[model samples]
Structure formats: C-alpha cells, structure tokens
Target: MGVLDQLRKEADQKKLSEQETVDQQALRAKLYKTQVLPKMQQIFKYLQELAEHLNYLEVPVQVENYSDRFPRLGTLMQKDYKINTDGYGGFSDFNKLVQINLTFYCIGKGELEYNVQTKSAIEQENAFLHAKRVASKMYRLGGAGREESAKFVVTKKIPVRVRFEVDYEQSQIKVMVNNHTDFSTYTEVWQPADIDDAFLDTLARYLLRKDSEFVSLDITDEDRNELRKKLQSIKHKEEQERLRGVTEQKNSGLEKKEKLGDKMKSFITGKINR
Candidate 1:
C-alpha cells in the first residue's frame, strides 16, 4: 500500500477506537444514573420507612447521618435504636438496654447491616426475649438469620449481627446472621426479585406471632391476626381500585374512537351532499 493510504487507514482506526470508548463511557454513565441510582434510592426509601415504622411502634429509635463514617462508600445512612427491657422507661439500668445499629451502603452493590449489642451481662431470659423482638422486626423487613441470632443471644449475650448484602449486577442478596458467641453464622442467599414488602411483612408478622407464643406481651395473637386480616383487606381494595382505573381508561379510549367515527361519517355525508 502507498504510505499515504496506510496513514489514512491508521487514522480511521484510531478515530473509530476513540468513538467506541466514548460510546462505552456514555452507556456506563446512563446505566449508573438510571438503574444504579434508582435502586439505591429505593433501598434508602425502604430503610427510611422501616425507621418510621419502628418509631410508630413506639420503639426508641434515632436516625443519624452517616455519610461521613464511610467516606469511601459514597452515600451511607445509619439509624440507631435503643430497646430497653422496660418499655419506654428510658433504660432504667444501663445493662437492660440493647442498642441496635442499622447501616445502609448506597453505592455499587448495596449493603445493609443490622448490629445489636448489649453492654450488661447477657441474662439468658432477657437476651432471648430481646433477640426475638429484634429479629422479628428485622425479619419483617427482609432480613435473615433469626434462628441463629436467637440461639446466639440465648447462649451468650454479647452482640448479634444480621447483614443483608445485595449485588445489583448479579441480582442476588446474601444474608448472614452472626453472634459473638462461637462466631456461629447462618447464611441465606436470595434473588432480588424474591424480596418484596409483602413477603417481608408476612414473614415478620409470622415471626412476631411465633415469638409471642413464648413471651407474654400486651399484643395478643388475636390482635395480630386481626391486623393481618386488615392488611389483606387493604391490599384487596388497592387491587380493586387499580383494576377500576384500567377499565375506566379503556372505556375512555373507546368513547373517543366512537366520537371520531361519528365526525368522519358526518364529514363524508356533507362532502357527498355538497
């Protein structure tokens, strides 16, 4: 080939390569903004909802800004809840309160950590009761490791940790529940599609009801069952409303088509008559 032709071919290839790189970068940025950002926002929204639900349930919970704690992780949110043996009495004994920390990582694959710790000695009875309460609440929100954490608290009271780590790329979630005692861990793997609010709520309510069987509290089985039924009824009503909306939209479209047909017919008749 001539020297000029060779040079031209090289220039063309170089330009194409540069354009491809730019296209790839643009695609990556679009994916991050649309898919990754929305997933992070959804996780953050649910976390906020969980915190609100706890507060509504009269649990002493505090939400804190933890963006600075994990500077490398981009955006992070944390919430701390203090659960005392005595309900709402502001922790009469330092040892009687269990501190639960929840952290959410909002970049790359999202990670949620639920760590519970007690400063006082682990009383098996109190520890068991506390673990059940904490686990039940966490499980309701798509957390796993309840049995193992309960066992850990029952045997040795130091700290129980349950973590839900999600990989958006792989669409998978890994759950680990662990305790300081024996370093025992329970692991569960799930697909992101399998985790939903309804599933989590149902599981959580079931756990709470099971726990109530052992611990005597003001909330009874009847009360829980009633609440479950009420929630189901609400869901049914929502579905009905959604169906009604779709039907109305279909009817509106049909009405518009009929009006257009009548106008067309009138126009044709007018033209013929003229």
Candidate 2:
C-alpha cells in the first residue's frame, strides 16, 4: 500500500475508536436512567421512611445525585448494539450498574452508646433483647429467616432491603474518680453521638397479630418478654386443666364401683330375709 493511503486508514481507525468509547458511556448512562433509576427511587423512599421513624428531621434524599441522567449507550455509527459485545468494542449485559449505599448521621438530641456499664449483665441483656427485637420485627414483616413469605394484599407496599452497615461515632467526656490514693483517677467516657437503630420496633408489634415479616419495625425488650410470659402462662394453665380432667375420670370410676358393691350387699340382705 502507498504511504499516503496507509496514513489515511490509520486516521480513520483512530477516529472510530474514540467515537466507540463515547457510545459505550452513553448507552450505559441511558439504561441506568430508564431502568435503574426507578428502582433507586423506590429504595430512597424506603430509607427516607426509615429515617423519618427515627424522628430524623431534614433527612435529605440527595436529589443532586440523580441530576446526571444515564446517557444512551455511547455509540459512533448510530446503529443499535446488543448488551453483549466483546471487550474490544461491544456491549455488556451488566453494563449500566450504579451502586447506592446508605449512610446515617445523627443531627438530634441524646445519642446512644456502647460501653462497659456498671451492670454488665444488664448491658448483655439489653444487647440480647435488641437482637431478638430486630429478628422478631423481621419475622413479623414476613422476613423471619426465609421460612415463610409475607404479603399485603391490599396496599402492596413492599419495604426495600437495606443492607446493615454499622458506623460508630462518639463524643468523649472526662469524669473524676476519687480512690484511697493521693491522686484521683481520670476516666474518659465515650458516648455514642448517633445511632441508626430499628425505629419501627414498637410499631411492628402494635400491628402484628402474628410473627409475620410484612409488618413494621418497632420491637423492644418489654414487648418480647411480655409475649414470652404470656405463652408460658397459657401453657401452664393448659397442663393444669389436663391433669384435673384425668383426676376427675379416676374419681368417677371409683364412685361407680362403690355404688355397684352397695347394690350387691342390699340384694343378698333381701334374699336372706326372704
């Protein structure tokens, strides 16, 4: 080939490569907007509702993130391309993926904390109760360990799954401890400034007649213990009634035997007199 022709071909190829890159970005953005954005919007609603229950005022949905629409799959030739293209210059089925993560900030009064308390047992109990409450809430919501399905036939409001990510921030406080020594002990208190806890715990119980996961989020220690106590009481009463029923049957049999003996004694007495 002539040198001039070779140069022209090389130039054409470069332009085509650059244009292909733009096309890919465009298409990725387009699908992201049309298909992905709607799901994201629903997820945001779920998060917002969660925050609202926690009484978080000014829980911003961060609308600015959605401003940049997903562009149409970037392209050069304006011909339609399928989702699966070879790595060199093709499409991918998993192309338009945008990850959304949740972050909670406490801009409220009286935050929560975790620490070595004076009553270790009480602290342990609190932790245990909280975990149970969370689970029971999930169950009532029809999310109890994947055993059963939960649904609302009327409204069809499904809560989005929010992945749990624990983030801790604390504010330190200094307390003076006086012992028998000349020098006083300095204790630094670390308290939680914010907590993204299950806010729907109480609400869940109010509505849940059963442990269905399709309900609300508020589950607490008192509620759980109350339930346990009730079940125990019911079981005990049922056992007592069952035992009482057996005793009654035995007594009735004994009384019937005694009556039969009396009848035979009276018949023998009459026969002798006759």
> What TM-score goes with each of the models?
0.30, 0.25
Show where candidate 2 strays beyond 4 Å.
56-101, 104-274
Residue lDDT tens for model 2, 62-172: 211111111111111111111112222332233332222332221112212222223454445446435322111211223435433322111111111112111111111
lDDT of 1 by residue, 1-274 (tens): 9999999999999999999989877875665455444443443345446646754674432222322322333332222322322333233333221222232211122433433333232244345447533222222122354323311212111243444454434434554444311224455544444456754554334222222221123344576566556555655765786777844535778779657755655543333221
Error of 2 at 103 (Å): 3.8
Q: What is the lDDT of residue 134 in candidate 1?
A: 28
Give lDDT for model 1. 0.41
Q: What are the runs in model 1 whose C-alpha is more than 4 Å off? A: 55-101, 104-274
Q: Which ten residues in a row have the lowest lDDT in candidate 1?
A: 149-158
